[model samples]
Every structure is written in C-alpha cells, then in structure tokens.
Target: MYENKISARQLRRMIFIETFGAGALSIPAFACYKEQNGFWSLIFYGVFLAGTIAFFIIFSGKISEENFENRKIGKTGLARNVNINVSKMQTRLKSINFPEVLPQPIKFVYMIRFFINAVALFYFFGKTIQTVYMPESSFLFIIFPAAILLCYSLYTTLQKRARFLEIIFPWIITTYFIAVILSFIGIEKAMQIGNAGELWQGILSDNIFRSMGNGYLMLLCSSPIEFLLFLRPAAEERGTETKNRKVEDKNNKEGKNNREGKDDKAIRDIITAVAGAILCNVLFCFLSVRTLGPTLTSQSEWPVIKMMQLIRMPGGFLERFDILPIIFWILCMMAVLSGYLYYGWSIFQTRSGGCLKNFLGITFVCLVLLTCVVEKHTLLWTFYLKYKAFVDFPLSLILPLVVWLFKRQKDFNYQEKT
Candidate 1:
C-alpha cells in the first residue's frame, strides 16, 4: 500500500521542520511570562520529551513486529480466522487513525480542534507576511495568495513535500544560524550568563517547577513530533527487502534481527531530529531573552523576530539581515501549515466516499472563509491557549499511549492462547 516511500533522511528533515514550526518563536516569551530561565526549562523538558519518545519508539516497534508476524502467519490456515482482526488493528496502529479509534462525538471534537489550529496557523502566517513584508497591503490580500498556494501544496504528494523540505532545509538552517550569531552583537553584558554556576543556579531556581510545567505545555503545543507517528511507517528503511525467494527463505531466520535493526535506525533518526529541533528552539529562546530583556521579550508578539531586528550587521554589509530570518520563518510556517492541512484531510479521506473530492472542495472554501472572518487574532490565541492543553495533551500524548498499551495487552493475550 505504501508505494512512494521517503528515505530516513527525508523523514528526519520533515520531523525537524514540523517540530520547529513558527510556534517556536513564542518559546522565550512563554518562559519570560512564567518567570523562568528559557534555556534551563527547555533543557529539562527536552530530556523528558526525549525519554518519552524513546519509550514510544520501543512500543511502536513491538506493535510493528506483532503486525508483521500476524501478516506472515495469515498465509497459513491456522491464523486465517484472525487475519481480519489483525489487519484492522494494524491499520489503526500504523497511521493517524483517530477517526477509526474515536467515537463520533470525540471524533467531531478532534476535527474541530485540528480545524481551529489550522485556521490559527493560517491566520498567523498571513499576519506575519502583513506585519513583516507587506505592511501596506490588506490582510485579505496577503492571505489570499498564500491560501491558494497552500491548497496547491495540499494537493501534492507526501514525497513531493518531503523533497521540498530537503531542498530548503540547509538554506533555512544557515539563515537562522546567521541570524542567531548576529543577534549576539551589541547585547548587554550583564544580561548574559557568566559562568556554569549561574547556569546551574538558573536550572535549580525556586520557579523550576512552574518552568517545567510551562515547558511541558509549550512542548505539547509547539512540537509536532506526533507527526512522526504517522510518518514512521511511510519512511523507507534500508536493507529490509528480500531480493528473491531463495534469499527470503535463507534470511527468514534473520527477519526479526532485520526488523530490530530497522526499528533502531528509525528510533535514532527520530530522536536526533527531535533533539536537534529542541536545541535550536532553546538557542532561539536564549537569544531572544539575552538580546531583549525579559520585559521586552514578554511584551513583544514575536520575540525572536524582534531580537533579529536588533541585529546590526558588521560594516553595514546587509542593511536588513532580519529579512532573511523572516523569509526562512515564512518557509517553516508554510511547511507547518501544509502538514496541518494534509494530515487533517487524510483523516477525512479515510472515511469519505466517491464525493470526497467535492467535500474537500467545499471544506477548503469554508476554511478560507473562516480564516478571513476570524480577525480577532488575540481572542483566537487566548482561546487556543486556554484549551490547547486539554485537547492536544489527550490527542497527541494520551491517545497514542493508550493505543500502545491496549495493543500490548491484546498481543500478550494472543500469545497466551497460542
């Protein structure tokens, strides 16, 4: 069923881009608001996140093994009766099968949650363009072209999206790194951390608990590593194919080892990408706090971007180096917006009928109209922030863990019966 598979490298890039979306720009502000050191909070949360993801990877591997074994056994009469059940479970486990797993009311809520998030992101994208590049342009005009482009992108294949990310990943990283480096110039010396003791003290300060809580919430809302749950099965692993019947039978005994190797590689790639993105976010947050004091950082809407504007290029070589980060930030936001649309649409596609295309067309029109009508960006942000913890936590973290545990128990029971 998975014909157009992306390489592990492409998968890593996708994860990084998704995890480091435009939401990351607000990390420093969030830290400042909570009155905590952004660097320390991010480090602590990042370690916790990495550990959780590692456990999830292990669980996913076990489920994949069970699925593979069940498929293999289905070729024989002994397991024929359980093939349908196994296939259903595998389908639910492999992808974002929320529509299948969730009840109608809960599914409706999930749909609404994702829709609101997509609209907010779309609105944010338009707002960024209007604020940074086209201050004179109408908001509608700014988003109209962007919405059209997003629709076109949504129509494209996953492989195409992954390829596009691969093409721009290096450029985006370089631009961001340049901005980060330039941001260090002309900053107050006292604002910077002087020694390891200061850094350690920051980590163990009185507000550490609050900082960790806020960091966890930020990680939940900002990091889209949950996308990896859907992407892993589609990511191609090397040395997993059998060339011929002879080779297949010869290596049949080694199949488990091969699967283990593939799982290990996937785990490593995902962890690396996630960790790199987290580190980048930490650096950006740290720079924002250092360049702009906590007061300004918390007050500013886009602290990182504002910090970029404070950058003074040496020798006046680049009059406005901030524009580079803006452009790259827009690219990252585009990837994130595309991911939201694509994954949300995929959920509908799974259950829809022959009129699915028509339904999507109507839905696109409504989405664009909603984006246009939702002018209260502040209210949207408030609403999202107020309820995101409730929704995203359950959907992203709780749901997957519940599914994994259920599958594990079922597999164990099956083994006992056998």
Candidate 2:
C-alpha cells in the first residue's frame, strides 16, 4: 500500500479532473431542471459539500488519534474492536468481500452498481467521440481502440496514473478556462441581438424546493467526492514519515506538527478541488444558457459542445477553434473513464493475480459486451439517472453518518472503561 501511495497533490488533481469531466456532462440536465437558477444551485451544493468534507476529515483525524492512543495504552476493548471492524470493512469494500456488518445482499447490489457505472462511463465516452469527432465512424470503431487503451492503462501503476494527471492538470485547466472565456463571445453576440438579459430571466427560481430537489439529484450524479473513500487512504502526507533513525527522537514533535499541517493541507486540497470543479460546472452552465438561450440548451443532448461550436476564434486564426476544446474535453473524458474502470477493477482484487484476475477480466469483457448490446443510449442514461439516487444517497451521505455515529458510541464506551 505504501508503494502504491499517491501524494495529496496528485489526489487533488485526480479529483478535479474526475469531478470536472463528469459534472460538465451533466450540467445541461441541471440547467434544464433549474433553468438559469442552476448556477445558484451548484453554489449551494458546493458549499454544503465543502462543509461535509471538512467535518469528515476532522473527525477522521480524531478517530485515528484515538485509535493510536488506545493501541499505545494496550487497551484491546470495545474501541479496539470497533476500530478493527471498521478497518476490516474499509479493506473489504476496497479490496474484496462484504464485511459481516453489512448484509450479504448489499455485496451483490454493490457489484451490480460498479458494473453499471463502468458501462455507463464507457458508453458515454464512445458516444461523445462518435457524436463530436467521428460522426461518420461506427461506434465499434471508436470504442474498440478506447477499450484497448483503457485495458493497457489499468495494467499500469497507480503512481504513473497520478503523475500523468499531475502533468496534464495545468493544460486541462487552461484549455477549459480558455473555452469558457471564448464562450463569452457568444454572449456578446446575443447582446448584439438584444437577448442578453434573457440570461438572467430565471436566475432565481420561484419554486425553491423543486430547484433544490433537482440540484440534489444533480449533485449526487456529478460530484466525485465518493472517490475519496478509496483515494484518501492511498494519499501519503508529505513529511509525515522519515527514514533517518538519528533524527527520529529530535523530529518527533516536528513530525507531529507536520502531520497536523499536512492534514490541514489535505482538507484544503479536497475543498479546493471540489469547489473548483463545481465553479467550472457553474460557469459552463451559465455560458450554455446565456449562449443557447435556455430553451435550446435544455433540448440539446450535449449543450456544452453546442455552445463551443457557436464560439468563433478572434481574427479567424482558426476556422474551427471549437476543435481545440473538443480535443481537450476528449482527454478529460478519457481520464474520467479510466478512473471509473480502475476503481471498479480495484474492487475485484485484481492485484492478487491468478484465477481471480482471469475471472475479473472475463467479467469486464462481459460488461463491455453489455455496453455494446445496449442499443438505446438514452435509456441507459435514464436508468442511471433514476437508479443512482438509491446508490449514491445511502453510500455517500448515510453511510458516513452511520460510521461516525458508531465510532462515537465506541469512543464513549472506551471512555467509560477507562
């Protein structure tokens, strides 16, 4: 696990890419749901997500400290048992098996959820390429190469993936921001046509509860914070560990301080990544409605791409400036697809080779075939939109709260014993 560890910086970049790519795709839907008020909905969700993440991180640190102190004091009571059970549950969730604490049926359902998500990602990736770049090409022609590339990527090390993201992070951000800025040209054109004020026609929804309900669904589908459950454990805090024995005693206090600082940095990194992605989504949502006039934006399958096509490069330096953003967006989509497949692969214990790997590989092939056999992409989207709520709500929000409550009870019991 130490050898496979990624830094907080790498984790931040990974989160940003995953969240931004996935959220951008769903922005048009959210826009349709709330009209121009979607940006406000995104802001509210971002703030709520930030506060939730901060609380989780702080409480997780406290739990870790308490576990450590209990270990040092040789107290193998309720606290230690509870901690061990939680650790086992995390391990099982990430690696293999379903912990006894969760019902057996949940394991089967979770496996189905992972498969559905992976297939949906692959389908969307191929569909986007076919729609935008190769309208004439067969979907098979587009997806086959992508599947091969994704398989190759899965065989590579996590460190390499993280490093790749770190290197490309700046370029992705720049390309996306440039696209957003260029989109303002469309807004300017709309203003010249005397429809600029229409952009704010429904900036605040009259039915706030309806807006919130739709936004919550959008947040569940878009936000990648659930990845942190797997990613955070793999993120190594810088300066928290050292190889030099001579300085161990001297740097004990320094190491403690560094740990605290690094934890704060980790929390900041997460908040920044999530908030940045949300803001980017909001910007694109705003630009899409402003340029496409809300009605068309709501109707279009890919409103962001449509908005990009409407953008003309200044001075005609390039006839198709939209090509640049489309290319960058393709890269972002590939990253997102890879992330989904990689995490799904991890859950099947692919690292431990032999029969298990073979079995999982076969299962993956079946998923790809299933993706291909599914003729109606719209139905797939409908299924995902309708069902993901059940999966995301319980897993993302309720699960964490339940764990926190259980830990608090264990801590209370431990204190009573002491």
lDDT of 1 at 120: 78
Query: Which residue runs of candidate 1 sit more than 4 Å off their true CA positions?
Result: 1-4, 55-59, 62-110, 185-206, 238-246, 353-355, 402-418
Any idea what lDDT model 1 has? Answer: 0.67
Off by over 4 Å in 2: 34-39, 55-111, 191-201, 237-239, 243-256, 313-316, 350-355, 376-378, 401-418
- Candidate 2: clashing pairs of residues: none
lDDT of candidate 1 over 265-354, digit per residue (tens) = 777888888888877877877787766766687787688778766655457777776676776778888888777777666555554522
Q: Pick the candidate with the highest lDDT.
A: 1
Structural similarity to truth (TM-score) of each candidate: 0.81, 0.77
So what's the TM-score on candidate 2?
A: 0.77
In model 1, residue pairs whose N, Cα or C atoms come closer than 3 Å (at least 3 residues apart or on different chains), thus clashing, are none
lDDT of 2 by residue, 1-418 (tens): 3446679999899888877776575566565664444655665566666665665565444334413221122345876765553322210012111122223344344446666776777787777778877899988777877777776665666778888888988888888877767677544676222354643446554356655665676566554555665566556643333432234334245646645676677778877887888778777776766567656776776787777777665676556656656666667777876776665565444333322546546755765687786645567677776677665445655554555566578768978998
